[model samples]
Target: MRSPCCDNRGNNNKGAWSKEEDQKLIDYIRAHGRVCWRSLPKAAGLLRCGKSCRLRWINYLRPDVKRGRFEEDEEDLIIKLHALLGNRWSLIAGRLPGRTDNEVKNYWNSHLRKKLASMGIDPDNHRVIHNARLHRSHSSSNATRSSIDKSTNGLQNNSENGFRDDDDLNLDLTISLPSSQRTGSDHLQNTASRTLLLFP
Candidate 1:
């Protein structure tokens, strides 16, 4: 069986990575390129678990990984993308060039969640909390009013057939048959003259 990622019994290092460890990982990847995470840790001489090594390289050490603060435009894009895609961080990060899913997720949890809540928006559902409450209140009252209005106006507005008197109630619904049944033959056309059969 394939072993667990960070087997506690093993002497695998945990917590923060040092500069030397980082260099070793970078050097190994630069020379050989990423092969397999499970094998990479031992091959690269890293004491870290394969999962840790992979995360370090992808989220931090990769040359293409964008460092420093996220730009204003990037933040806006993140917010909009989050609204559309919900918690699918990897997909959201895909749009913002060089941003890793971990970085984007951390930024959202640390910064954006609070920022949105401050503006009265529920960070989870991305809805205006106040407006949502108001909407519920208004919806319930409107539903009640609508029910009362329908009951009061039913007799006056509708005839015995449960239809408005002045309304054009056409019971003439047409059904087009298959093309095989609608052939150009005169005898067939005569037999099925109208194509549509009406019922009273």
Candidate 2:
């Protein structure tokens, strides 16, 4: 891997931090409990920038960090948080104790995204749009009333009254029904209910 950008040869003697360097940093931190990052390099005998030292300490050498694969619960929590926060991996990771944002992001891209896509959901929006005829089978009050009126007019006008001219019938058939009758309405309702559950 590339060396950290903060590493400089001219500083406290650049290059990768060895075990001795790590120990020196740890000892200094233990003794001083963290000084200013800009001043830390000189005090700790590190050639790295303040930012680099801080990143190393927080991401790698932190005493509290738990290193390993995430648990099932952690993965589930990450997914739930990601759906709400989108690409804010740090925010998602915040809900997962002992997990890092980088780790969560990688898992999302590699595993969860694929799983969602395979299930016909848009990984980006977490919604599925299938072109089924049931989705087209909606009904509207005006439409239902019109159909009832047309049928009544046809019955009253004559045997042909219940039936309209082929062209007229075809035109009426093009009207969209209400979305509640659509095949996906149940799914949409479920999603809405889940959202309500989350908040309330």
Candidate 3:
């Protein structure tokens, strides 16, 4: 009767590692520097599979690991990198110091994707907001031109009735104001205002 490779007897009586098991694995890896996973459990006196020990050490016990909450800048970088790299979590994690691919993947799935979606930005394509902005600008320009044309047509029609009034000019001014002004929050206020006036 042959036993399974992962059986308790084959694993040297180890299953899920305890805190003590984790400490033993860490200490062994630190002293020995990952010579071989096949030989690690025997060398470290751990009752666990070499593969399990390696995973625990690399994923959880590595000294360079950053275990706390992801910072704001880290979150932003993750979003940008994810946009560029998609689910190539290892590549994204490589750009982020002390963060693991598993950690980054979890954070993206749990937080960053939702945040981008909430901002009306596509997590998969970062250019969604830019495209929307350009579309809105084009539509706004068309609307303003349409309004001006309508006002001009009204004025031409009314020339037969009477002279143009101050109220008519005021209406034109109001209709034209937004076309010459920016539409966004204070963070973009100066840039938008400058662009609107300059471009107009």
Candidate 4:
């Protein structure tokens, strides 16, 4: 079918594509390769627009695109990569050849996220959901700390903060500060401020 994006440049179809349209796209791509999306539709005698053709090819018609349900290994790798990569689905998809970025993103939102939630892990942060409680703790503590600061004129809590509960949350973090930020009385004051995440 032609896509609305085509400006009906002569009854261009839109919405769901037909089997014939799919075949046309596949045959065209198979014959001439999938480059020059902006010119591909006309070259292939399709009413569809270039953008639609590109999406159809990348998400469905491509010879290497995987179909059916995601495998267990893919699910596991998705979780692990998600923990490290967050919403960079393109990067994640690159690791799994034959899997498209949209497919991974959809599977994550529709299925794997729920699976993680069922197991008490946050798919977003890839950490225990309860650790979100730390945010509340941090806020209240900051409030208290603020009040204490007003009263004591510079009092500090340098003992141990709950943010160090990485083992409980199943998170590992490293920190690096620019020399400009790290070299100050902060070193003498024994305060480490806001360099708690470093990933290479």
Best by TM-score: 1
Q: Mind sharing the TM-score for model 4?
A: 0.61
TM-score of each: 0.63, 0.54, 0.55, 0.61
Q: Tens digit of lDDT per residue, candidate 3, span 1-200?
A: 77543436654745577888888888887787878887788888888777777767766888888998987667766664554346878756766777788889999889876665545455554433544323223443344333433433444345544534321221211111222232443112332211211112
TM-score of 3: 0.55
- Number of the top candidate by lDDT? 1
The residue ranges of model 2 lying beyond 4 angstroms of the native Cα positions read 1-17, 129-200
Off by over 4 Å in 1: 1-3, 131-200
- Tens-place lDDT per residue, model 4, 89-160, is 876676677888899999999987776665545666555466433332444334432332332221122225
Per-residue lDDT, model 3, residue 65, is 81
lDDT of model number 3: 0.58
Sort every candidate by lDDT, greatest first: 1, 4, 3, 2
Error of 4 at 11 (Å): 3.6
Indicate whether candidate 1 or candidate 4 has the larger lDDT. Answer: 1
Kindly list the per-residue Cα lDDT of model 2 for residues 23-104, writing each as its tens digit: 8778889989988987897788866678777867866676866788766556555555554456877656655656567777
